[model samples]
Target: MFVAEAAGLDAIAATGTLRVPRTIAHGISGEQGYLVLEYLELGSRGKADLLGERLAALHRCTADQFGFAGDNFIGTTLQPNARTNDWVGFWRRHRLGFQLRLAARNGYGGRLQSLGEQLLGALPAFFAGYSPQPSLLHGDLWSGNHGFLADGTPAIFDPAAYYGDRECDLAMTELFGGFPESFYAAYRAIWPLDPGYATRRDLYNLYHILNHANLFSGGYTTQAEQMMQKLLIAHS
Candidate 1:
């Protein structure tokens, strides 16, 4: 857990990435995870815009290849990253296929599995012409995962850090509401999304929804199914 947290912090602090809290201490006590971090206090709007701009800059820091220097943790499970010059190949193997297989073992069968395969096949079309950089992403950038400093600068925490598409970070923001229009406006002002992103959003978000389904069964299964259905429609 400590190494995962450290990697997360490093990814966020790395050049072209968003700024986040440096973890002072983290450990498991009893049944709960404990962490000590630098505090930042700012409203959602200002912090949102700060995050937006910073994320754009991070995305701009691309590499000729996809994947990271090493593997990291998602929640508690180890996520391996084997380097590849192809973004589509990287996401298909390391992201979608890995998660889908995990979810299937955890009782995610049927349509979800079928849809995942279809999405994998369609990746090339979805991401055509848009080569992504190995941006240092917060990995997990939900509203609850971020905050502001006492001076009102954006401070993010609890990342599933990696070098991948910047949209993965942006898509997580929309998963649970805490961001404002200004944040998106600022992001676009810095780096615009590719034209086909609208079609790809559901596909990208499916990775998270599937992960959530594996982590917490309940409404997440329904949510994952809904997202899969939406992707299938687009594909059809």
Candidate 2:
């Protein structure tokens, strides 16, 4: 696990997609594995246009395949990322299947499971003609994971880093809310998202909400249910 994390971190740095911390140290703290990363400083304009432009450039970086060297951790759980040439297949297996299975184990069955299956089946149609290359992504790129440096440069941290669809990166940004209008505008100017992206956004976000429901069962269950229903309606 540590080796895989190190490899992904190295890949991110090598690609110049996002800034990887200078020191990625691993050690044993009792029975658990610990990873220590350098701290990044944030400035006042965390959502500045320059940072937006940088993130756009990062997302534009792509590869021939859509998978990582190995799976890594997200929040505290292991994310299974088996390598695959097909972007749709990779997403189904690692992103959708893995998250849905975990959610099911945590008592999120019935409608949630059914909708997940449907979404998986519909992925190809949803992403038609969009053969996504392995883009360097800060996989868990929600609002909280990114900040601006002292000079207003964007600094992304706590990456669930991987090579997958750029839309996944954009979808996550909308999930929380730190991203500004300039960010989306800058990204569109560089590499425009597909028209179907709006439809797929809810489907993609369902994975995260379901994961949250599994992790902390509060209002997330209801939220996940609602998202699933919305997707079902769209597909129908």
Candidate 3:
């Protein structure tokens, strides 16, 4: 777990867009995984525009295909990132399919499971005209995953990093609302997203929501169902 985290940090830092903590050491300590990182004295929020622009540049980091060289974890859940040339295939199998299957095995059944299966079947329609090349992403970019150093450098940590749709990162930014208008504005100025992002955002986010449902069991299962319902309606 810690090793994968260090690798993700290195990948993001390679982009030289946002700040990433240097992984000093990583190892396993008697049934526990640990990653030691260079501690940064975090301060208040940094410039939103800079964060947005840097994140956009980071997303420009590309790959020959979707997925990492190996599997990693998103939170405690195992995230398989085995390489695939087909973007939708990667998202369907390694992403939504993996999460939904896990959820089902954990006894989450009925409507949420059914709706997720339907959405998985309809995945092709979501990418009808979109042929997205794999882009490096801070796969879990919620509000808590980012901050600023005392020197005002924007640092994002605890990434579930992958080479996939850039919108996945942007979609998670909107999930919890730490990002500001200047952030979106700066990002658009650098790499403008496709017009279909607004429609596809929910589809991307549903993976996270499904994972959350399996992990924490809040109202997330319901949320996933609702999102899929809307998506299925649109596709229909």
Candidate 4:
């Protein structure tokens, strides 16, 4: 896990789009894997607009295919990052499908699995005309993952980095409490999202909530089910 995190930090740092804590070192100490990162004094508030613009710039970094060189973790859950040419197939097979299968393994079945299958089948409808370039992503981007350096520069950390649809990052920013309005406005100002993004946002976010359900089975399972049902209805 430490090694994967170092790789992810390196991937994000390579883009030169945003500031990431430098991965000083990573290795196993005895039976425990350890990662050392450069410390940055972080504050909750900073340049929200700049954060948005730089994040958009980060999204501009793209790959020929979706996924990363290796798999990583999303909050302790193993996240697969097998490269593929098809974005929809990647999401279905690795993101949502993987989580749903894990959920089933963890004994969450019946309605949840049923809705998940339906949502998986209807995935293509959401991307009928949209073919997304595999842009660099901060895979587990949530409000808690970002902050400002003491210099007022926006810095992001704890990445589950991969190359996928840029909107995946944007969708995650909106998942919890959300970033400031300036962040969204600035991002759109630089690279306006597709007209179909509103409908697909929930689809992208479903992967995370499902991950949450798999990681901590309680209200998140219901949330995932509700999200799946809504997605199925939206695209059906």
* Candidate 2 residue-wise lDDT, 1-236, digit = tens: 66556666666677665566654698788999877777777654755566567677776777767777778877767887777788778778887788888888887788878877887787777676666667778788787776777666677766777878778888988998647888888778778888888988876777677678778889987898788677667766
Question: Which candidate would rank higher by lDDT, 1 or 2?
Answer: 1
> Which number leads on lDDT?
4
lDDT of each: 0.76, 0.75, 0.89, 0.92
Give the Å error, residue 214, model 4.
1.0
Write down the TM-score for model 3: 0.97
How far out, in Å, is residue 20 in model 3?
Answer: 0.6
Model 3 residue 82 CA deviation in Å: 0.7
Tens digits of lDDT, candidate 4, 137-227:
9998899999998877999999999999998999999999999999999999999999999989999999999888887777999998888
Can you list the residue pairs that collide in candidate 4?
Answer: none
Better of 1 and 4 by lDDT: 4
Cα error, candidate 2, residue 45 (Å):
2.3
TM-score pick, better of 1 and 4: 4
Cα-lDDT of candidate 4: 0.92
Which regions of candidate 4 deviate over 4 angstroms?
A: none
Task: Assess the local accuracy of residue 33 in candidate 1 as a C-alpha lDDT between 0 and 100.
Answer: 79
